[model samples]
Target: MASNGLLRECVQQLKSSKHDYEKVLGGSVEVVWQSVSSAIERHLRLKKGVGVPGLGKFSFIRDFQPLTPVFLLNDRFISSYGVSWKRPPPSLVIPIAELNMSVLGSEAGLPKDQVAQTLDAVCAFVGGRLQKGSASGRIPVGNVGFFQCEGKNLQFVFDPSFVKSLVQSSNDAKPNVKPAADPIKPTVQPNSVANRTSIAMTDAIGSISQLSLSRLVNEEPDSSSDKSSDQKNDKRDHHRHHKHKHRHSKSTPHLPLSTQSDTQTSTSTQSQQILPRFLMLDPLRAPPRHLTSDSKYARVQDSAYERETEDVKNRVARSAHEVEEIARRTKAAQLRYLQTKAEKSVLEREMNAFLHGQMEFKRNAKQQEDARRSSAMEYDAVKILPRDPIVTAAQRREVKLKLRRRLNDQVALKDDLAKQKRAVDQAESAYFLSKLQLHAAHEQEERAERQRIEREALVAGWTQQLAVRAQHEQLHPTRKHR
Candidate 1:
């Protein structure tokens, strides 16, 4: 297998790919890469797949699988680039400092400590994967290949079948392929951006025009004008009628006597009289025009009286219901209390009876036992004494030895208990000491953290002041000389 380029070269290539997202992200190549790499790491941690545009997807697998990022190439990209893998994977070991420098672009802009931390995290993840895979003797590296442990050494086993299948499937799934260009087609110079934009605008206008023409062909003739004309004609006739009425009125006599008395009376009656005969009855009359006027004052008063009576009735009903509920609840509580009292009395009576019976039984048994003992003592007194008694010194000696051994064992047990007490005391003291140490350590850590924060703030303020001083010097360089 050919030797692969260093990580530096890889980072350079990545930076070159910055054109892919430069306009969209509006960030430098280093920033974009950092964001992308962090996102990839985050996705891997969550066991989700991360996709790099125009490149491939990196996925994480669960279970006994190797903790490696799986790179699945895009079919179109693979075909365009004519990508192929070597049989043996090349070594990718690089110093943490170098990798951090490459990734961050500048040490002055980004802290080395932060870079080092990030590099450590990445290395830890990779090492974890290596360890997990080494356990199973096989670690899969997505579409590229896999690593297998052979004895003490690890070796890469390349397999291009999976990648090839992915490409084939993608090619099959893609639709609407344009016709292939001629093999010997003449090369055309690329147009300027402005010219291309203008051409696109012209095409868009032409398509819009064609669409409008098609709509015009399909649309029915508009009848809006005819309706508008009729409306105008009606308006004109209305205006003329209004003008004629105004002139006629001015020409007519104004005297009430000039009008017919019968017509005037008929209009007055019609305006004053109710429309429905039923409405003439007070109970069935239409609602009064003025609720508080003299004409409807009696009705309003009656309504108020009725409302008051209803309110009184509702109050009485509510009070009665509330009284009944309270009485019912009180009665129920009293009944429950009586029932419980009765049960308690019954239980107490039964308990007293049981106790009395038990005491009588015990007294009788005790008397019977005393009588049996007296009978046995009388029988023993009447029995004849043994002719001879055997004496054994060994039995007496054994009894004394057993008693002495028991005493010695008791003494040893007490001594052992005292030792245990001393051990417990020592353990308690040690525990107290440890607790004090832990508390002191915690306090020290907190103080250190606070001091570090204060230091960082002070440093930031100093840097800002320095920056301001530099700016002032730049703006007023000749002031000192003057």
Candidate 2:
């Protein structure tokens, strides 16, 4: 988050410029702003100033309490000359600001403190967030219009060019659109999915409202948590199988055992139908005779047109009937497929359980035969269990040597543990420092980027000022017309 003092500067300049030229008169006396009545007389007498062959005229107009200069910068007059002043409608400002906030990287690039500061700066006197979002700055001067960015960038738009371009669409007539403030930065990265989607409760789902945003953020399942449950299910499945086998093995003379259940399906848990909400509108009462001025033309056209309409409607009905029949057939086929699948699953489950029983039968028989052979061998030979490797080595070692080695290994193990602990502590410290450094560097980069943009803006502003002054000189009386 970075910003500048230009918005305030623009307002101050506007006020000063207006204050300097409220009234212009012949030399030798203080020229006062005319009284309300006198000003009306002067204004009524003043025609649009004539233009030179290559340069445009300059005029003065008032907005709020300030009288400001309007230049015909584009030859006829600067785009500013044609403004018919009115308080901008609420509809326009609100939507414009919303669009800008969305475009300016989801307000995340700006720190909370800085965002509040900017909001306060632009919204100080009037206009509020809407104008702040739309205007770049609240103060609009006459012809020499300026826009401000958070120390990020600033721009002066020839309001006229914008209007002309907008007009060249539709009827090819651009509306009188106001100039705008400029970019947050030169390389203002659009808010990424990570950032944009990060706007938890009120992110823009674009056309979707805040309610939808709430649903999207809140509706997502915790995927990591889901993975944990899957692991638990695997363990549970083993446990379940163990119990099933143990209980079956103990039973033979009692009631017969039934097979386990079929595998559950996804559709079993979630049932939803995607049906459209169909609506039909009823016809309203016909209008009075005066609403139909051309009775004869209507009468002649109505018959043919009505027949054509009816024919089209009938054709549509037939097509709809065909579609309905196809849909009905498809639904029946789907139902049959589902039923056949259910039957197949049941059969598979039973078959698997039967196989398991057969495997247990063979396994039990083999174990009994092995147990009998082991018992017969035990009568002839004494059984000695195999010793662990460490115990066997200890049997051959001197007690003194074994004790020393044991003590040494204990010391080594402690040292190893200590080393591991230190390594872990260092890792933790490094991780924390790296996180802090990364965050600090990110903020620094953000600041530098913003500053770079501001510098670019200042440069552009200087260029525009030179161009405007050149244009003004072209209209100078002492200089020959270009």
Best by TM-score: 1
Give the per-residue Cα lDDT of candidate 1 at 225: 43
- Candidate 2, residues 1-482: lDDT per residue as tens digits? 11223344434533444444211111101111012112222322242222212222234342211222243332122111221122111110101011122222232443333333333333232223222333334233222232232221223233554234323432333266445424421221235332232232122221122111111112223465467558768878878646555445754443222112101111221231111112111112323334333455345434443454455456545544554565568668966876786677567546755765687699899999888887854655566799866656556677779899999999999999999999999999999999999999999999999999999999999999999888878779576553
By summed lDDT, which 10 consecutive residues of candidate 1 come out lowest? 89-98
- Models 1 onward score TM values of 0.19, 0.18
Q: Supply the global lDDT for candidate 1.
A: 0.48
lDDT of the candidates, in the order given: 0.48, 0.40
Clashes within 3 Å, all models in order: 0, 10
Give the clashing pairs for model 1. Answer: none
Poorest 10 consecutive residues of model 2 by lDDT? 89-98
**Model 1 segments more than 4 A misplaced:** 1-295, 375-384, 387-482
